[model samples]
Target: MRKRERLELIKKLILEHKISTQQELLDILENAGQTLTQATISRDMNEIGIIKIPGPDGSYIYGLSKDKLRQEGHRIDETPSILAVSPLVDGLEKMIHVDVVPGTSRLIKRQLLTKYKEMIFSLIADDDSLLLVAKTDFYQQVIRQKLESMVVSDEQ
Candidate 1:
């Protein structure tokens, strides 16, 4: 598999499982049919900004770095609803457009890129809008659904 695909899988595994050691992560990957060396996994984890955070039982578990997310303007304490006001999401062909609160387009863009990097070809953001070019029509629809789900209704 390609590096991007492998990285995506690693992220998913880390998020979905309590992976503590490099050996444990390697074993899980091998069980899933991914054959990679521990050195390569370590490099990939570093490249993707994954870090060991304190788990529930005081052990360290692999997790995405909150510092990196904060540096990207994504507040770890705030949800998407706080950054956007009923964002308008629309898509056509292989492109998806999202309209969010002014000054928050960049944050939303960063979130989208982080979550859907493999599906996205290019993403551009202005003061209150974003234009994402997906790798395929299917990816465009998937991205549209994800953006739409983040929309908060004024009624709620």
Candidate 2:
């Protein structure tokens, strides 16, 4: 499987179980039909920003890094990243929200596909705007908020 696919699976496993150590995480991967070394699990943990929080048994289970919230989050909305793109289409679910400068849609689209393929399913890009298809509608609001903040930051 691709690194992105592995990461996605890892995320799913982490959410499903209380991962306490590298060995446990590795075992989860192997059970999922992907095997990796302790080093790879370490790297994945860091990359995904996993957190070690105290579990009921007094051991720390890997958890969603709260820092991710600081980085940013979003909610889906009617205004799809751009004017033309939309939630209007049936089965056209959104997965990410990203923004780029005017006339840089193609550039942004390329970069997103290259850099954040895991976070997005499909993409639509136009001048200064981009729409990302996500696994769930929950990400749409996050995308919208992140893009709005970027626009605000640019104005500042």
Best by lDDT: 1
lDDT of 1 at 83: 32
Worst 10 residues of 1 by lDDT: 79-88
Please give, for residues 24-101, the per-residue lDDT of candidate 1 as tens digits: 999999999998998999889877777665579986677776555676675684435223323334545887666665
lDDT of each: 0.75, 0.60
Candidate 2, residue 60: Cα displacement in angstroms equals: 1.2
Which ranges of candidate 2 are over 4 A from the true structure? Answer: 69-156
- C-alpha lDDT of candidate 2 relative to the true structure: 0.60
Q: What lDDT tens digits, residue by residue, belong to model 2 across residues 1-156?
A: 999988878877887897777798888778878879888887886677665554689756776544443355623222222223333354554644444434345544664567656666678866456767765666655554544544433223
